[model samples]
Target: MQLEARKIGFYYKKNRWIFRDLNFTIDAGEIVGLIGPSGCGKTTFGRVLSGYEKPQEGTILLNETPLPKRGYQPVQLVYQHPEKAVNPKWRMEKTLHEGGEIDRELLEVLGIKQEWLSRWPNELSGGELQRFCVARALRSNTRFLIADEMTTMLDAITQSQIWHAVLDIVKQRNIGVLAISHEAALLKRICTRTLTIH
Candidate 1:
């Protein structure tokens, strides 16, 4: 499988393009890194690729077909802030199961505790909540993952652990990953190749 973005363009204001005429691709099982300075529209491009936002021009294709309009999306996005991703009203268990049946092995690998499932979003630490977010994005139907600064806030050890778990699952499932971050060393360490926006 491959995720391709062709001739993409986006803008928030008239005559102001966040990015335009962009093209990129990520083949299955590839770890691709996207790096640029802050406010460079890397996250916006990730959103467009994941179908969270429609590009003003061109198309995003998954293996030469348009992204699915309904049902579970093949492309999943795990954003930087897990707190903002979850529902404040729902318990951790509900949020985790939102995508589908929870995989026990995945939960264990992500270090998600059984007791944390009953707690609210505020009750868990950022790292714990991010584990749920990451696990939720790795559902059976997910073909590609857009990790937009996914672990920027975590401590070094926690970040390493999460990345290790994510990479393990990516290899096991052959899921393509578009990792967006400003850390050059991280990109060099994990990505097969890196693309710079500017």
Candidate 2:
């Protein structure tokens, strides 16, 4: 899927307005980074692009086809915090199972061990949890990925490794990515384009 947000604007009952007339497009084999201050709606914008939110105005299109108001397929979101993103009771295998038919090799390529798949979420480290989260996302036939502050919590080494993992997925899958990050240098290293929001 190729994603395009056209003049989008959004407002939630709990907060101020966001994305006042924004515009951008990202296709397969490209990564676009979004940067902004906290609460400037960078994550919210990612959610909207990933089909988690519907904007009040403007269009969200995939391959020039108007995306539905709800239920987007073949696109997935990887959140900033992995611990909160996953279910405490669910085993690693269970989470990836939800996405269905995932190759065990894919997990290995993401730096996940097969033995660890049987463990619960709480047993994993921050970086390991994030890898599980990514594995879950990749289990689906996702063509567009929205990585909202995905590497902000990990150490520099793990962050770099995971960034490369994501890049590898994009390359092999011929996917498009909307990577939300505040670190300009790091974002530049991975993304083909970067847009700073407010």
Clashes of each: 0, 0
TM-score (C-alpha) between model 2 and the true structure? 0.93
**In candidate 1, where is summed lDDT lowest over 10 consecutive residues?**
10-19
Error of 2 at 83 (Å): 1.2
Per residue, candidate 1 scores C-alpha lDDT tens digits across 116-146 of 9999999999999999999999988899999
Give the C-alpha miss distance for residue 8 in model 2, angstroms.
1.4
Q: Write the per-residue lDDT of candidate 2 for residues 1-198, one digit (tens) a residue.
A: 578988888889645677678888988878888888888998888888877888888888888877655443667899889999888888988876774668877788899998888999889899999998887787646888898889899999999999888788779989888888888888889888888888
**Clashing residue pairs found in predicted model 2:** none
The Cα RMSD of model 1 versus the native structure comes to 0.7
Off by over 4 Å in 1: none
State the lDDT at 179 in candidate 1.
Answer: 95
